[model samples]
Target: MPDLWQNICLHILLTCPIFVNVWSRHDHLYMGLDHRHHHHLHYEKDNDLSLWINEMQVKMFSGFSMKIFAIDNGKVSPHIKDPNFSMYLPTIPSEVSYVNFTWKSGAKKYDYHFDRLQSLDENILKPPSISIKTKGRVPRNPKEFSVFLPCSGNVSGVAMFSIGLLIQTRKGKPLPGTPLRLTLRKECAHRGVYDRASLTASQGPDPECDKKCANNGWCNHEKICQCPEGYMGQYCTQALCYPQCQNGGNCTAPAICSCPKGYQGRHCEG
Candidate 1:
């Protein structure tokens, strides 16, 4: 007979088939996160996920994305690649601790090899005086922003982003152990400014969509509703139709296609 501990582990593995957690728990290793990507969840049901010593590889089918932040101005940017891979936030996060990630996104592949976060250039960082002054004061509203990195994906090989930090001296000199460039990356969807998103999204309501989401949807940075499945329309008030209504038909309810006159099939094809 197996021991109680082994049985418990086996039970968990059997019950939680949708997700997995891989960890090392080392005290020294660190993985900094950008202000945009916080969730590790996905809609991929048929995919292979593996975690070896210090590397992670996921054969994803439905979604994948990543981002990098400018250390100096606190500006975040997305990593653009061919055939976009997007996903909504607000799901259970998978705990996959690895320094490197290989996203086998079918035809379009993305490989990320994240090194330890170290020093970056001083040109992009705020002055040391400002840093020293704002040491312990966490802002109610962080002044960081996210933008798309143009041409960042057009590299000879895998797009390289070195997300680094900088520690300056009193006289504005780059400290001893920092890099010459800054690379702070993230991967997320529905991260429109203001609305704040899932595990890794901002934490407050944006002013543009203030009092508009009505507890059913998330307002994106564009002041648009990023609704959940089954709901649609401005502020997510209308129901969603799967195969959308026909040429002139309207979606009257969830999965309900209101066909136009003379159209008589489920999706109005007949």
Candidate 2:
């Protein structure tokens, strides 16, 4: 009887490895749906996407060890060394609709540059061709690297940028880490256009007033509602200052009647 029990236990142990492997793959496939506990560095949630630089030995290519740093938000993270180095950018703020890569350095020697960077927007008909403008001055540090992205603009989407170096030897041989592919989280959004549903949406206006303003008007902290072109009123509900502009008066401003000849008072209602 003891031998029979031992044999059964051995059979269960042999099959457990296969079951665990299958379950792990299944869990990964559904990670997006249940990401509250997901801790993998490579697969973060969409709203909390992070950028990273994988490990690679720069000295292997140029025979000189090189350092790398990520500069963003007026702050620089810790520097990375050759081989087995990874730099993870901060979790993307919800207000940031998308990233922008406006410029790059034009230095010929020992300057930081991206070898592999591209937009993740699948809708983009053709990604913008990165123009290496020789007109710019040499970038002294990572701050003045000419990449002033992360702005609000008409275009919106995830701007993927792969970092690389330009090691120009006397022989002009090709360098390593030429283009590192970045698997960016795709998003269709323009720069500087914070999501309306986010807390940052009220950054420029009074929280309550912004939601109260109607008919293309924006509310300010002082409760002054700024109406759009061709509209006026405290809440932008009235078409004109006097709606009908009695006595031929015109609406020069919201709720402020502009009386015509011989007409006066708030609504030009002599």
Full-model lDDT for every candidate: 0.29, 0.32
lDDT of 1: 0.29
- How high is the lDDT of residue 15 in model 1? 43
lDDT of 2 by residue, 76-167 (tens): 22222213222222223222222222222223322233544444442421232222332223242332111112222345544443334343
In model 2, the runs with Cα more than 4 Å from the true position are: 1-91, 94-115, 124-143, 148-166, 173-183, 186-270
Candidate with maximal lDDT: 2
Candidate 1, residue 186: Cα displacement in angstroms equals: 22
Stretches > 4 Å off in candidate 1 = 1-210, 218-224
Which consecutive 10 residues in model 1 have the weakest lDDT in total? 55-64
Per-prediction tally of clashes: 18, 9
